[model samples]
Target: MSNASPSVKTPLYAQIGQRIGQMIDAQVFRVGQRLPSLRDLASQNGVSVSTAVQAFHWLEERHLVEARPKAGYFVAPRSRRPALPAVSCPPRHSLALQRKSRTETIAVFQPQGQEVTFGAAYPVVSFGGACPKDPLFFDDDRVRVALARATRIHRHSLIEYSDSPGTQALREAVARRALHLGCQLLADDLIITSSCIHAVGLCLRAVTKPGDVVALESPTHFGFLDLLESLNLRVLEVPTHPKQGLSLPALQLALDTQPIKVVLSVPTLSNPLGAVMKHSDKRALVQMLASRQIPLIEDVVFNDLLAADERRKAAKAFDQDGGVMVCGSFSKTVAPGLRLGWVEAGRWKDSVSMLKRVQGGPTNVVLEQALADLLSQAGYEARMRRLGALMKDRLQEARGLINDSFPRGTRVSDPSAGYTLWVELPGQLDAMALFQRCVAEGITFGPGALFTATDRFRHCLRLSFAGAWTDVERRALARIGELARRQGDAP
Candidate 1:
């Protein structure tokens, strides 16, 4: 229905809805902004009130507008352009990664069923849409087919522990996939792991010992901090730009003053902040680290989501001397339940592969084969393109709601790709307190405090829109905004 051109074959009401969608897209009417009343629209377009109602129904179905109780239809928050978050300037020193208690870890997510799992404690808070767990996000039938085929093809492998370096077919598939990231990986060097985190863990073990200082962008994935803490490593968070990503100058300063061992970063479509370092910046970062003999654990997990294919190139693409350890997974972009990932460990290739062989065994041959089958699909790019478009829509609506309901000083990241959003609430708005409140109302998000070892992000939070897009999710976003406003209003 949304794809119908404004031609004669299109229904009149649909044509009206399409026009309104165009207006909303053009920002002639802001998201969360009201539209003409049914009567007003009917009169303006010389259509019946029923026709106007139909037009609004069409708009609502497309997420272009929403109706309020006892009020006429108003434009939905569908604008993806939110005010970008301010640059982050964390303390210039390194500190040991702190492993907070279960209580604190629980605050990172509320009760949810989509992409997250929690401990046996309190009720889960709803992420509205956390991970894309629902079948709506993937071709489940195709996934089942691939899995079945892989099992049939590799049934004999069940009798043995799979090859330590993963199946050659899957590794070759991974190498072929990495070409889009501009990395010509050798399938022989690629080691498939349980997941991306597993690959990163191997890299960390190969390079840094306990108490080693690793520099990364601020307000990063909490999972990284959890890994560092478990490994007994210290974290030096470089000041990061919300849009541009890690500050090279700040990182160079830290390296000059501190004993930084390794730099872990997501140069393209970084997590939480969704920042993408420029191509030149990526090269410069590689050169800068290579000169200092520091290994860069570059994560290209979300690099595929960047709107432009050229921008999707991983930082490892510029690694002249085997200095960048690149890791990635298909869970975010493909079937999450598959639980598979791969890595090219640069200079530490043998060490990482050996670590995987000893510490964590290779991924199941059936799963690897299934993933290989999925990757070999001719329509994979089209599937990702659709997912990318869906993410843009969700991000736009989320930003609109944040603009409409959150406190005035609130700022959110505006990324061209990716499903996660970083929201910086107004002054004195404690995100932890806000999380507690949101949990009560069945709405939850990752508080900024959990993202770092520092207390600097006390007023920020990260939200993901990878879950199913439903009215409940939409209302949850509005409720979160309302609850945040109340936090500031509290005495």
Candidate 2:
């Protein structure tokens, strides 16, 4: 909410200066026009005169505004900057998916030192975890209380293994929560798993054997590709729009030609792309899947992060014949440490349950009960609100930086929700090389090649602004932009 960088290390004055810089770049103050007086500016920004003075001085140093004698600073005339990057232009034809060598990816091992990481898609340390960060998002005391209550009440079940289909209380809780996504789920139909991805894997395994083709958004979560690869399933990459989500016509083409056994998608707040399917489009997608008798594994892990209520509706909401299976986890929304996920397998509930039981069995009963308590509590919505606001602020800051600092031809995504940005660098810059360069500078970001089965996002990359956008992260973004510019300049 505040313009302050959230990082204690970044002084309030510096943030104020950055805010003013942004305004200037937008041409808020014309050249030769006197700027607001120091006192008024301070009052406007809720800062002290000293801070305002410091901000103006900082601007003057950059030659953006000049301080005249006795008069306040005036905006300096500057050449017009280039336009932002354009939307992606991937090849029209689908290609056979290939396995990537492990060395191609810069694996995100545990941080060793003060590395500025934008490489991994996970939330930053401040907002890190599958669940909302404790204290900042979810109340730690509340979680502990729920855990204690669950333990006290279900102490006898501690020694016994959990139900293969999961605890009844947790299933009921999940059913209640599904209403928000416009899904009317039965507790009996739900199956609990170790995590959301675990549920997705089960759905994949149940629906298709190895070598069967699966259709997915072209620029999907790298994790999805990893799962598909491990499953030994061939992938048919469908063309996904930056904002509208999977192209239905493109998908229809894939369905007509390829032997796609199932479709795995994150319809709401899709990973990397952050594309949200329109409600009508969602219905159409469900109908199309039903017509083809294909299954949909909808990942609603990031659905709660959408600002608009309409945008949070999952594709499963439109399912009438169990063609859509909803997969979710609390890692991104509630608490990551919980490691709990759920799946409503539609018609394949029995199969998914069997696979889950055979593969990994049930999750911890106490943890499931605790999560149920957390979900049933009133604070979950408020926590999501806080998380969404924080993510929006971080995203806006990052998008602005990318627009201003990145190479002239760099195209960036303006997703409706979530913290990830899909960047298409101009001049055919190799994202892997960019990743290596950033790593050398103690900075890391997700390269484009890692996200797909084919050569779709070779010049693209993904950046997550889910963490605190401190001076270090900001500098890292600028450094990436500089590197991108240099890469574009190279022969």
Candidate 3:
């Protein structure tokens, strides 16, 4: 078990912290519940009190527990005990994607991009960013060395065009990674694209023509909406739980009622909401789609960020008849600069491969080789753990601030892992109006209106904590809440 654990290379106290973490996750110890005294834990585990203290400290750093002056240790409340956002039930009818003006699209799309300044000389603090930016989350030196080694090794390949379906080494590397998601994919079936978004676009193109209907989670990733619009596809948004992911029953109903050609979802650590489907539910989702012959474009870009191996298993693992097209990239969890993403197209392999060649073509083989090297290296899981902990600390702290500073009745999500929080402000407080106010002050977050084609989420916003968290950033977050509070009862 130790050999398999990402925390194996960590200190012994940290390893013990893992055990306590499992307990916490399983609800053997409820949130805000007190744990045994340090002495009792030491006696139970046959270690000294000093070691137990260190173990508790390790958990504290990860925000799994808190130390009080005389209250001993208690399980830290997730998202500071805020009421979770209610399950979303978007309008049942499938509707064509609305095309926005380029200027409006740029205003919303700019936040999700990696660039710091969006052509504005004035500085803006973005809370809508999706990529992790802090250096503490990844080992930059390791990435540099890997890139250099791959460059030296594959120098001759630069003059060569990478194979249409990607290099064998990178494909094999992705197959190996699929194992972590409980998938035993064949490397031959994989096609490397520019990014996960690109892979999804290819999948959509391969399966459906323009004006085809697709069913996706409500308050879905805004990027998906943008892609659907570009493809001229219609969408039906299904009801989705904040923590459990897409509602299968709603999806089934949509399939029966609408001409849904595909289902696109982020089953594990879904963007913005960070929902991880239950294992049984994942299997059910695959089976449901397979029975209907409806293709599923499953996005697993954030799968590796989850801590538990069992929980990391993807819905694609349950695919039996090639109905699931699983897409992923390491840019979010590993190297953001690398424009590398892969997809196993299941039954639509040939179609997706052809689309890859016809569309943007293959990525740089040398960079792919570097990404392969990075993926196959040891301590990858440990790096993910580091990222998880860093995000955990910040998210908990942000939740606390939201609790104190946001409008009354404000609700936020409690994700298993990842860097974003879906905040539901008071219903009367228009989140788009709030976003405009924040932007005027040089601050920005994903307005709820941006996430959906409909207006259901007009009071919500997705706050991202992936970037550097300085005092200025903290104050900016607090300021957003202040504005929301002021506008809580406004018309």
Candidate 4:
């Protein structure tokens, strides 16, 4: 057979696709709007008919455009567009009624960076997204030795399916570590998960049926609230304190009156508020939950970030009747991309482990083993110490900036641990509006409303100092404060 020549590549098709994508992004061709016919597009893009056809086919496959029989390609309708499930909320009067102009209703201040992402709870700084900076005394040698050991022992098996409960060594490490928290857990008590979020999901699936009522912190982690909504669970909001954590009395009232199956909360280092439950409150709450047989899901992702003395206490520490399902993750302390987290399922270990199997078969074995190896290193504890100091310093720097720059009436939270600062703005200043303005300026943050069932904290905002240079963060803080003042002054 004669050799065939390679087909010539077409640049025109790519250019046409780019143009169409740009138009879609800019909303020049809005959702549901009919796209130009192949003939028309070829004429407009100055390309051959085949080139335009190729481009349209490419776009259609990627879901940016949809082909309609006899109608040609139209911008995908809203229903057809790929989207995250709509987060549910109770109906409320629109904020539009308060402002004279619709434009005025939206915050105009732009954070010095990109999109209006303040609605999402993430740190504006690069480092704020995940683990904190390591301190001066971290021992890298120990980590290396541990990895070497894991490799020598596991070798080929590292790539194979891990036991449902995770590596025995890792489970034992976790159980031994739990002892510091006053939790007397055996290896059997732990069910390893990909992340704390996964752990929470498994616990939810294990305990409650779909449509069961779950009580959550009024302004809790939006991710959890969204998860509950997706699982078709009805959420009942329980009021929480900004500093002391969830309200015990309110939780007690809800427990007594409502048919709540689970209470999800962050007893230590809450996401937006940076609240830590008092020891007495933790005892009372645990007792209450145990007495009522209510499962308490404690998100302790930030647990290890606490100072040494603080490590001795945990919500699980006080669970006399195994009512607390403690979920902890190395993502916050180590690396998030590693996705190493575990659930100390007090009484629901088998149920959670089974759910883990159903959800994704099993987590990445090599990654989990790598993390286990890293933990085995003596350097892990030293690295944690260093991270703690750096975080403490960063927290102080961010707190000072907020206190100095924010408007006079603004109340900044005084968190004993964790890198988040919760600022309570004047009632008139909507954090969501402020978020939009900041996003336009190239900054992003976690808005207050997403954390709550009601818009009760519309005036509040959470800032993370986990990442970013001190100079950039200080400037961002000053700009944020100025924006708050402007919004507060606005009629």
Number of the top-ranking candidate, with lDDT as the measure: 3
lDDT on C-alpha atoms for all candidate structures: 0.83, 0.77, 0.85, 0.68
* TM-score of every prediction relative to native: 0.84, 0.81, 0.84, 0.71
RMSD of each: 6.4, 6.0, 5.3, 21.2
For residue 140, what is the lDDT in candidate 3? 72
Candidate 2 global CA lDDT score: 0.77
Tell me the TM-score of model 1. 0.84
Misplaced by over 4 Å in model 3 are 1-80, 101-123, 489-491
> 156 in model 1: Cα distance from truth in Å?
1.3
What C-alpha lDDT does candidate 4 achieve relative to the native structure?
0.68
Native-to-model Cα distance after best TM-score fit, residue 332 in candidate 4, in Å: 1.2
- What is the lDDT for 179 in model 4? 70
Q: Count the backbone clashes (under 3 Å) in each candidate.
A: 5, 11, 0, 19
Worst 10 residues of 2 by lDDT: 121-130
Question: Tens-digit lDDT track for model 1 on 1-491?
Answer: 12211211346887788788889879899877879999999999999999999999978866678999888788786543447788998898899876684356764455455544332332344562345664555777777889998889889988986547888898999999999999899999999999998889899999999999999999888888889999999999998998999999999899899999999998888888999899999999999999999999998888877655697988999999999999999988778899998999999998998888877566788898999988887776766666676577668767877888898889999887887889999888998888866775556777888788888888998988876657677777887888899888989
**For candidate 3, lDDT tens digit of each residue in 419-488?**
9999998767788878767776778888877788886888899999888787778888988998887787
Q: Kindly report which residue stretches of model 1 are placed more than 4 angstroms away from their true locations once superposed.
A: 1-82, 101-104, 107-125, 128-130
| Cα distance off (Å), candidate 3, residue 334 | 1.2
Error of 1 at 57 (Å): 5.6
